[model samples]
Target: MCRGWCWGCGWCCWAWWGRSPPSCRRCSTTGRWIICRPVPIRRGWRRSRSSCPGARRPSWCLCITGTVGSVPPIGRPPPLRSPRSGSGIGWSPSRGGVPAEDGATLMYPVASNGPGTDEKLRDAFVERVREVARSRGGLTVEVGGPGALAADAGKVYESLGGPLLYTTVGVVAVLLILIYRSPVLWLVPLVVAGVADFLSMGVAYGLNQAFGTSVSGQSSAMMTILVFGAGTDYALLLVSRYREELRRVERPYEAMKVALRGCGPAVLASSGTVAAGLLCLLAADLNSSRGMGPLGMVGVLCALLAMLTLLPATLVLLGRRVFWPLVPAYGSEPKARRSLFSAMGSSAGRRPLTVLAGGAVLLGALALGTLDLPGSLKQEDSFVDRPESVAAMRTLAEAFPGQGTQPISVITPAGRTEATIAGIQGHEGVAAVERGRTGDGWTELSVIAKGAPQSAAETATIESLRDRLPESYIGGPSAEQLDLKDTNARDRLVVVPIVLLSVLLILVALLRSLVAPLLLVVAVVAVWAASLGIGGLVFGPVFGFEGTDPGLGLLSFVFLVALGVDYGIFLMHRMREESLAGAEPAAAALTALRTTGGVIASAGLVLAATFAVLLNMGLVQLVELGFVIAVGVLLDTFLVRTYLVTSASVALGRKVWWPGRLSREPAGPVEQPPGETPPSRERVAVG
Candidate 1:
């Protein structure tokens, strides 16, 4: 007998009772009569009397016919039809019937010969499973199954990438057009920047593919901004100088050559410093940060190469048309002090401390915002709005309470017989435990944190879990993040010293002054700290941003040092030129400002505007970074260029270029010698 009820095709029955019952079928002794009765039906069915019409007339005698076959019983109802077979029931008394004295019940089991029961049931089960699989799309069988966190991140990233890139590029172009004024001049920097971007990305892709290196999404976006802003800056400097030279030289190629020769070293030095600063990221522990080190260095290298090679070539090809229609032709020396910029510089030089103090106080006020900075690293916080990932996260949160995010795996050795996994279930801050099998005799446990996956609290929880685990268990987010954090901490120490050393080396090479690079380093450090302090105040307090992005600090340090040195070189070069003209200390400072101030300010504005495009990105890190560097450039150009260097040069007088014996002796109130009119009406180069 089957353990449960059996349905044969469409007929349902109690299999055991139907075949071996004493109550239903019977056999007779005389003439071998037999009879079988149908199972009972619902109350509404009527019994047919046609089989035994003469019922009461010795009905027991007819049962004595000695038959042994299926037949209806005497004085009982006829059998019912089989539903699946669609056959009528007919019982023959000659075949089998029952007699009162015989008292024997005959049972015949129903058999299925075609399309057997097991085959039909198996086919039905398979069909049901197929329906379920089709409905589900087999996603549960594949990686990143439906509604997975990784899949969600992928979708959100793609959606944001398009609009964010568009917004950033559009903002950069518009801002450049506004700052440069000339449409023709605007395209040159952008074109150089575009080439640099492509080359950097290509190199990064190759490195990632070849060396198994990968930059984070945030860093990739930043590389784009860095190349654009830095590229444009280098181009602007060279072109501005080239324009100035075009007016002085007869041939355009000569002017181009002079511009490249003069600006080439400065550009190389600046790019080198920036690249070195980025290489400092290699000291970072986080894979993302470490990846950025090489990625950023590559971008700076490309920008520098473009500035040195492509830029010079393009200038040689374009000639005067590079500036177009607005070329500065032959003219008398410009009246330096009469220009609005020179007057401002002269006023600034007169009250250097006041300008310095005012700038310092303003930066100090903004630096107050740093106090409110939060340290949470929630993924939603990385994006501008609550993106689709956020919505999906909400859905997941609602569906599964306390299943916040992916857990960090804490692996313990199976060989450690003293270790027990039971303790992990009770670990503080661990919400759930998923046991995973390693190779033979090894095991791992995933300890899900109680909050957002990437939050500082979660990171802390992971650390705490690591501490709680037995020494046998290796614990952390992944081996990768742990290595990254270590790299970052170590890098922080190594990068600064290397950068400082590199900057000093470059300055020493350029100026041959031991004292000059030291002063420059101090100024760069002061400006960098002040910029970060100001950024902290704005983003941390007013905007409710986190601590300054680690990348931003690293990148800004490089920019401030390298680019700051460029300004230093320009100022010192002009001062040297003025000294050769036999000017007094104060007069030379005035002359340097009057000659280089406009170009420096314009170049700084263009660079700052370009960097500001990063603010349009969705990442808060980029926003903080964009503002910080933009402000840094402005300070370097306006305050540092106009006051600090000028005032220092004035105080030092003839001693500013000391030891190298570069500065001319102070000649008191000397008149302009022949062919050396007080740069009152001279035409300087403009790119």
Candidate 2:
């Protein structure tokens, strides 16, 4: 009972299409002349009782083209019998059409009642088609429509489900092994995060069943990825701090307590910001976008719970031997080594203004790549790997030069049906029209356009129809995509500022300085732009993508600005702590960067790699999203957070924390660390 236009994204539009009279005489097949009229798939229809000139009965075949939302009803109807002859079957059909090879002989063009888009119904139809095809010897009966495509897409997802899970687990295990350098230690984070992931799924399922929240392949994939990624991040921060605390506290449980106390605020803040920012998507009118908010929040919160509660508990139970070979001995200072962050800090400290200006210029320049970005992606181009639906559409495009294969449905109030149909017929782009099911107070009108689906002329016609028939809800796959595009634009105006303002407000509260929060916000926002710009440059040339997804900018912006601030929180909090402990501003900046740099770097690598897994998905949108977020994390890690932020802090000194108590208390010259020698003309000072 799918009454009108429905969409599973704008990737494919489905409709039944064929050409032939509703019912023709079988004897007429001998004649050259033939005509097609719109046929209804309803239970009863009038048909002429006649035989073709050469045949005893009418011969006919039905062909269809569309996605899951529509399909023709199964089996030919019984011939109409005259009231005087109850035993007589009276209508005849022509079976004179030539074999359809590469769509060479297609003359008739119309659709019948399609199998409508529903998971179970589509599955059943596809199964039935499969039996028919097999009996006829390998797809001899071509039901070229979206049912096959929808059925295949479902199968693809089912096939991919197991492998995608294994891939995520495998990647997480290997990365944790590399990071921990311990056989036993790596297992803890993986096991805990995996549990959290499983729990999130249960919770998501409950939400769907209880609240009727939308759940789809896209939303579920994003949810699982976020859990593994952000969970690992919280784990890294806690574990790193725990290791450092172990050297001072002597006991494992005591050390865990100390580490949690030290890093809890930052971890809490980081997860909170991500959750709040994702929740902003609830404002989107699109169901996919709206549903993702709760899924993402569930993922983040589940990860946070695991990291804070389960992660620590597991580590405490494992004891210090978890680190085995590299266990931190009590009362020993960590080996003094000049790491990359130390060198970077020294460089930025020496020439803060130069580093800041150069990084800013680089970001701005990369952002110029937006000019090269292509237009919006078409439905056929939405997937990285073309599915059966897209292949069918492509075949039809080649077969029919200038006709629409899919239907654009206009569902109007029953009272205005005539007026709506009249207005639609008067539209410039229409090729044909058919009246469909009437249910409730609505009448369904299916329209075939003169232009191909999703073309400019068709797009204009859709808009024109909407304007002319205001009482109708005009929709289909193409129309849904059009609505998606418009909604994304509207969301940006409303949601982007909320995201920025939300992050800004959080940062200001955490740092207690308008200038410092402003700097971090501006830096991350630039990172977002630079990341998208990088996507623009590579999506077309390197990846051979058709065009950028419309939702790309908004999703990427939210993630980068929100998640990008995680490292900032870790670094700036440490810097503030050091400044409060009586260190000079420059020394505090350098010390904070040197101490937290490795942990933040490792966290970024884990988060970025986790997102990079999305590249393996079939959808081009996911690939683009994965690529941009991964690239942005690396850029934020190696460039912005490490260099630009530190440099700015070094240059601004005490003023970076303006209006805060630390700023007023700091005035001393930068002091060298203990055992460091004074600088000379030949050597650069290390503070």
lDDT of 2: 0.69
Compose the digit string of candidate 1's lDDT tens values, residues 324-414: 5465675424333456557876876687667656765665665565554455334444545444434434433443344334445554555
* TM-score between candidate 1 and the true structure: 0.68
Question: For residues 336-449, what per-residue lDDT tens digits would candidate 2 score against the true structure?
Answer: 666778898999899999999999999999999888887887766776777655665666666665667666766667788888888888888898787765655666666878
Candidate 2 positional error at 16, Å: 46
The weakest ten consecutive residues by lDDT in model 1 span: 55-64
Among all candidates shown, the one with the greatest TM-score:
2
